[model samples]
Every structure is written in structure tokens, then in C-alpha cells.
Target: MIRAWKRFAAYVLISLAILVGMDMARADAGSTVAPAAGPGDAARSWAGHIAALRARA
Candidate 1:
């Protein structure tokens, strides 16, 4: 029983470590791109068109 408990604990710690490493990797992978107003403006325009179509429905 003790041996089983030890193995379980080890597995849990290793899993947690792997998850933390993945999270760190993802954070580091995040974009460094500067935000532009053009994309937001385009999206807003598209959304307005969609809303208009939805209103017709």
C-alpha cells in the first residue's frame, strides 16, 4: 500500500510539473505584435453588417 501511494504521488507531481511547463511555454509564445486600430475597425464594420442582416431575420 505504501509503495502504491509513493508511485501515485510521484505521478501526480510529474503531471503537475508538465502542466506548469506547458503553461510557461505558451506564455512565452504569446505575440509581441503591436496592436493596430485597422483590424478593430474592420471587425466593427463586419459586425455592424452582420447585425443588420440579423435584424432582417
Candidate 2:
């Protein structure tokens, strides 16, 4: 169904976004963007958020 496809697409997009964010965070490492706790850590948390969205869909 169209709805199923839409859900899958959304999941893929969210996964990609999180990956890109982590990469960017790593690229800026040690330049203040990385932060003491690391920037990509939040990206991992986004997986949970996106998982919820996918589940809802």
C-alpha cells in the first residue's frame, strides 16, 4: 500500500539524516562542534525517536 511505502521511506530518510549528522559531528571533532560529550551521541538518541515515528506509522 501507499501508506506502507511512505512509512518505509520515512524510516530510511530518518536513518540517513542521523547518519549524516553523526558524520558531520565527527568531521568537526576537536573544533568545539564535537563537544566534550561528543556530538554524535545525540544522533544515536535520534534513532529511538525515529523508531517511534516508524512504529506509529
Candidate 3:
């Protein structure tokens, strides 16, 4: 009975470790395409525009 319990514990621990490793690997593998940060990004930032307008006033 003790032997069976030991084996069960080992299996559970190994399974958990494998799951954690897979999650870490998945996080490292970022999306294939990078997000678009094109030249007009700054131009489209409404908050910055508002701040500029406020500063001018």
C-alpha cells in the first residue's frame, strides 16, 4: 500500500512539473506576427493630443 502511494505521488508531481514546463514554453513562444506599431501610432494617440492642447491653453 505504501509503495502504491509513493508511485502515485511521484506520478502526480511529475505531471505537475510537465504541465508547468509546457506553460512556460508556451509563454516564451510569443505570437508569430508582431503588432503594428506604424509611423502613425503617435499621431493616433488621442490622450497625447489632448495633453498637448491643454498645455497650449
What is the C-alpha lDDT profile of model 3 across 1-57, one tens digit per residue?
999999999999999997665444434543232334875753444344455445545
* Residue 30 in candidate 1, Cα distance off native in Å: 1.0
Q: lDDT per prediction?
A: 0.61, 0.61, 0.57
Each candidate structure's TM-score, on Cα atoms with residue i matched to residue i, is 0.52, 0.52, 0.52
Off by over 4 Å in 1: 31-57
Predicted structure 1: lDDT: 0.61
TM-score of 1: 0.52
**Which candidate has the highest TM-score of all?**
1
| Alpha-carbon runs more than 4 Å astray in model 2 | 30-57
Which digits, one per residue and each the tens of the lDDT, describe model 2 over residues 5-33? Answer: 99999999999998786555544442224
For model 1, residues 1-57, the per-residue Cα lDDT tens digits are 999999999999999997665444434545232334798865764455455445545
Clashing pairs in 1: none
Clashes in predicted model 1: 0
Write the number of the candidate with greater TM-score, choosing between 1 and 3: 1
- True lDDT of residue 40, candidate 2: 77
